[model samples]
Target: MRSDVQQQIISIIAREAVLEPEDVQPSMTLDELGLDSLGLVEMIFAIEEAFDISVPFNANEPAQSEFDISSVGAIIGAVERLICGQRPEIVA
Candidate 1:
């Protein structure tokens, strides 16, 4: 069962990907969802608005960013951490 936050995130990602929410899986990556750079940015914006939290994401250098965008599950975990006032580990 998905938590409210998970469901909301899935919906946001689904909207950005033009897919049904059910089709968005936790294991799926943004690339697998066919999200280009612009789509990724938009999704991030949606996430920020939904959670009312600032996401430490650098669209230009996502790989080096502290927030993980490696997969849907990772994104959810990052958001959860932020919501709890915890910063994600700094990626070196």
Candidate 2:
């Protein structure tokens, strides 16, 4: 189940991606959401402002950062971990 935080993030992403909230799903990748690099960066900024959390995201190289942007679910999980004040473990 998606947490309230996750839902908020989804809402932000949906708004930024210019898609309906119902179209945003955990399984969908940013590419699938039609987010270009600029859109992704904007979404990150919106999320940071919305959550009042510093997202350690590097849009240029997401795979190399502590932040994960592989999919909606990954983003939600990373945000949840950050909200819990824990660093996300690097998944192999």
Candidate 3:
């Protein structure tokens, strides 16, 4: 995994979610971080802006499932896949 990318994502989430760095675990879900739907949307947009990439949003396909975005690690993985132009797997 890309440690720098992971760290950048963790920093963004921690700052935006108002959570401690240690609290941002790899397996912790976004809901667990207290981010609602709007927060999630904002987070995604922030990520896109930060990385200068577009995250494909397909209404029919549901690019990312709720379960897939549960943790800092998962979120980083998703971003990496997006930057690489690959769809993320919905893995919990």
Candidate 4:
């Protein structure tokens, strides 16, 4: 379920950043979650590892023009899309 994904993401972020679970929020920005670029990369890796899917990284395109993976919900949505083999909606 969606809650499972949320929990998984929270766990990954907490583990990586050494933060408490209560600190992470569904609407919180990655920066608010205390995740820098390296932390974001680790989060992506954790999501991929947990879901057994590879998240496509289009470095040539702007992030906003790709998937807006700026929050927990967006990250979970992206993972779901990848697992379903569908393209995520690119948010500008």
Candidate 5:
């Protein structure tokens, strides 16, 4: 069962990807969803706004950023951590 947080994150990603929220999956990568650099940046902005938290993401160097963007589940986990006032584990 998807938590409220998970569902909200999926909705944000789906909007950016021009997909239905149900079509977005935790295991899916943003690339797989056809999100380019611009789309990715927009998605991040939406996430931050919706959650009322700052996301540590750098579109140019996503892999080097503190927030993980490797997969949908990673993003949700990171946001969840942020909402709980915890720092995200640095993605390696």
Candidate 6:
């Protein structure tokens, strides 16, 4: 059973990808969805708005950022952790 947050996140990403939510899988990477830098940024913004949580993601150097957006599952886990009061480890 997927949580509401997970479903919403899938919806947001799927909307951006112009695909169906079912097409978005947890193991899939953002790159696999053909999400460019702008798309990734937009997804991040949508997620922040949906969860009302601050994501420490820097678009320019995402790999070094505290927030993880490498894969759909990663984003889901990160959001869940964040909403549950687990702060992202500040990389910088």
| Higher-ranked by lDDT: 2 or 3 | 2
Instruction: Report the C-alpha lDDT of model 6 over 1-92, residue by residue, as the tens digit.
Output: 78777899899999988889999999999989989998988988998887778888899998898888879999988888787774333211
Deviation of model 3 at 47, angstroms: 0.4
Model 4 regions more than 4 Å off:
58-65, 86-92
Give each model's whole-structure lDDT.
0.88, 0.85, 0.70, 0.68, 0.88, 0.85
- In model 4, the worst 10-residue window by lDDT is 83-92
Clashing residue pairs, candidate 4?
none
What's the ranking of the predictions by TM-score, best on top? 1, 5, 6, 2, 4, 3
What is the TM-score (0 to 1) of candidate 3?
0.72
Clashes of 2: 0
Clashes of 6: 0
Q: What ranges in model 1 sit over 4 Å off?
A: 86-92
On a 0 to 100 scale, what is the lDDT of residue 89 in model 1? 35
lDDT of 5 by residue, 1-92 (tens): 99777899999999999999999989999889999999999999998888778988888888899999989999998889887874333221
Instruction: Please give the distance, in angstroms, between residue 54's alpha carbon in candidate 2 and its true position after superposition.
Output: 0.4
The TM-score of predicted model 4 comes to 0.73
lDDT per residue for candidate 2 within 25-44, as digits (tens), equals 99999999999999999999
The 10-residue segment with the lowest total lDDT in model 3? 83-92
- Tell me the tens digit of each residue's lDDT in model 1 across 1-92: 99777889899999999999999999999999999999999999999988778999999999999999999999988888887774333211
Q: Which is superior by lDDT, 2 or 4?
A: 2
Candidate 4 at 20: error in angstroms? 1.7
Q: Could you tally the backbone clashes for each prediction?
A: 0, 0, 1, 0, 0, 0
lDDT of 4 by residue, 60-85 (tens): 45274455676777876766667667
C-alpha positional error of residue 15 in candidate 4 after TM-score superposition, expressed in Å: 2.0
Q: Which ten residues in a row have the lowest lDDT in candidate 1?
A: 83-92
Residue 67 displacement (Å), model 6 = 1.1
Find the candidate with the highest TM-score and give its number: 1
